[model samples]
Target chain A: MDAIETNSLGRRFGDVNAVESLDLTVQKGEIYGFLGPNGAGKSTTINMLLGFTPPSSGSGTVLGYDLEHESVAIRQSVGVLPEDFGVYGRLTARKHVRFAIETKGADDDPDDLLGRVELADVADRTAGGFSTGMKQRLALAMALAGNPDLLILDEPSSGLDPNGAREMRAIIREENERGTTVFFSSHVMEQVEAICDRVGIMRDGRLIAEDAIDSLKDRFDADSRLVFTLDTVADDIVPALETMNGVTDINADGNDVSVVVADASRKAPVIEAVGASGVTIKDIRIDDSSLEDLFATLTTGERPTSRHAEENAANTTQLIREADQ
Target chain B: MSWVHVARKDFADALRSKLLWVLSALMILVVAGISAIPQLLYIPGQGPAPGFDDGMSFMFTWMTMMVSIIGLVVGYRAIVGERESGSIRFLLGLPNSRRDVVVGKVLGRATVVAVPTVIGFLVGAVVILALYDGFAVTDYIGLLVFALVIGLVYVSVAVAVSASVNTRAKAVGGVLGIYLIFDLLWWTVPMAIYWLLERELPGSTDLPAWYVLVERLGIWEPLGILSGTLVDIAGVETVSTADRLAGDVPFFLETWFAWVIVIAWVAIPLGIGYYRFNRAVMS
Candidate 1:
């Protein structure tokens, strides 16, 4: 059975359609990444699936239980770490986990759960003084209390430092390895690409793309750009590289030549073509479109928004200003 | 069962709150001070001024007011406070239904209110027995039960208001409105009704129905029911002028029926509030 299945499930807030006609499916035991930009209906969809908010139209189910009527049963089996959850300031970490255990009727040890989240040392301390990251860890420990069949975490890596985010990824992997279906939502592409077996991207209350990481990269027609630094500029190299199969956009400036190839397999032929021009090669660099680039292309559908693109734009503007001077 | 767990946790958490402790201390002082009124100011030949029954009635009046205030303090933030702080997400993320949340909140806040009320009543009982020469244990017990029921009635009203409103300020304002109307201005309602009838009809020597209707309206007010029930239970005529203005008490004003009204106060608001609470969308 699918871990989560929604058939055109939609929700509207007043006149604003927050989630509209969203049909999604997540197979059991796979870590499904839910990716979206801000205000992209990610939280709204999660809220509807968990029954925190009802859908304005359509139908859905979690673990084969009806979303609307069997919410109690679904909640009993599915653990949720909501993006904007709050801890009781008076309750300690242990108390929070214990409450979840009691609520789920689960026979899990609170100490073990807290220890997994690295919160064992301060298990007795109240959460009132906890930092944001500490609170996130405590909430994660509580969500793991029942050994649930499915775990739905919204922005689980939020508020965590680099090391903390790595630890969170390890925990997600551990949970997924234990035959648990994990539905993780995040805006961090690196984290999602590292752990997710399949991903579904939401854009403006709709699922824009859903596939494996590699498949999504392929579907977007991501290409590799080869940069070569030569001893001298060769007039024949640009035309020679452009005529080659699977090669396009060949440009030479001073001693540097860059070419966009349709795939990595075209790398050898482009290098051979450059060698035939009789210009001595100084260095060669191959820059492939990573998932970050593909994400930018798929989401924004234009110039990549990564730092590299921003730097390139800045350098190009500087060159234009210098020429004017 | 889920509600029981929620209530148990809520009760434990509320017990640790500084606000509950402050209210409990204030109530204890009030009960002690009221109990010592007879001994503090004595008049010779006043025929044993202010015996146990009078002390009990005085304590009931003060305690009723305190209970109303305490009920609002305990219940005004029950549901809306969680929603405002975003903790309702953590709560409803569990296996609990919305009905469970409302039921558990009411039960937990009722305990918070009941604890201090019981303590104050017990201390008052001890003081009355020691100060007065002859004190009936049954009458003291009767007053204790009556006072507790009245306290619960206020608690129900407060919880109902909390559940019905979406913001803490609105919940506080709603309960405060209940307090002003039922505790302070309750008698004016029946008086206004009588004046309207008199103005319209001009001549009605025997207005028994109007009198009965006025007495019946008393059931809606916690203090009215408390005084009426106290009169029947202890055979003490502590009811206010509005009740006696009818010259003869109606059957509905009897002590036994007064108990019914007191219990109904606990039931009716809770039922309506729970129904609305179950249908409300949790943020």
Candidate 2:
């Protein structure tokens, strides 16, 4: 069974359609990455899945339970770390973890959960004085309670240092290995690319693209560049390389020749073409288009004008006018 | 069961709050101070003297107001404050439903207010017993129960306001508005009604209907219900303020009915608030 499935699920805040026609599906035991820019409705979609916000249209199910009518059952089976959540400031880390355990009706040890998040030493200290990173860890520990079947994390790496983020990724990996389906939203491309099995990119409250990371790059026609340092630059090397299949943007800078290869399959042919030119190859370096670049290219492209966006803008303007009055 | 967890967490959190502690301490001090009034005035108090009853009655009157104020302070931020701070997400992220949150918050705040009220009453009872020989245990218990219920009523009011409003500032403003209307302006309501009726019907000298309306309106306010109940429970014929009104007390003004009114004050607002709260969007 799919861990989560939504059929054109949508939510509107007045005229602002925060999430629209969001048809998404995540398979069991897979780590699905939800990527989007700020205000792109990533959080809104997550909120709808968790039943924190009701959808204006469409239907969904989480772990075979209806999103609207059986939210409590879904919540019981799934763990969440919301994007904008805050801990009870006066409660200690131990108490927060214990509260989650009790709420989930789980047999997990609070101390063990805190230790997993590296919060064992300060478990007794009130969370009010905790740094943002510590609080994030505490929240993660709370989410880990009950050995949840599904974990939905919104910006889990937010407010974490590089080390802390690495630890968080490790925890996700461990949980995934334990057969927990993970759905997490993040603006951090490196973490998502490193961990996500499949990713869905959102733009203006719609799922713009959804596929495996490599396939997404391929679908966008983002090529990998191969740079070669040559012992000698033959006069015809540039033209010959350009004429080769799957090679484009061939350029020569003194002893270095650079060309964009459409995919890994084109790597061998491009190298063979260079050798055929009699230019002795010294060092070869291949640079693939990072997910970051692909993300920028995807989100920054000319967007289709949405009625919701226009209505939202009009509503905002009206609000401003009222405020001025 | 989930609500029990939520309530326990909220109770623990409230207990650690410096503001709650300060308010509770102040309430205890006020009760003790009020109980020591006769001693402060250097009056010899023993047996069933009028002075002893007067002091106890006076303490009950002010204690109701203080407990109501404390209840408002304890509950004004119960739900809306969490929503404003984004902490409600953490709460709802668990298995608990929105109903669990509302119920748990109300119960938690009620406990916070109830504990200090009990402490104040117990301390005041000890002082009253030590100073006056003929203090009735049943009357003291009655006063304690009445005071506690009054506290819960205001807590319900504050929680209702918190649940109904979206913003913390708005919730605080709403509760304060309730405080002003019920605590400060309640007395004026009856007088204002009388004045308007007198002006509207100038020829009618005996406005018995208006008097009955005022008495009924008085039942809605916690202090008024508390005073009337104290009068019945303590077996006092008539309070000084009411003695000048020159009329028999209405049936609704009886003490048993006052208990029902106080209980209704706790229930009606809570029902409306929770109804609205269940449908509220957490965002």
Pairs clashing within candidate 2: none
Clashing residue pairs in candidate 1, if any? none
Clashes of 1: 0
Error of 1 at B240 (Å): 9.5
Minimum summed lDDT over a 10-residue window in model 2 chain A is located at A307-316
True contacts kept of each: 0.72, 0.82
Q: What residue runs in model 1 are displaced by over 4 Å at the alpha carbon?
A: A217-222, A226-262, A266-286, A300-325, B44-49, B190-223, B230-264
Candidate lDDT values, in order: 0.76, 0.77
lDDT by residue (tens digit), candidate 1, B174-283: 87787677656776776667677676532233445455455455434535555554544343455443444435655565545656776776778778777777667664
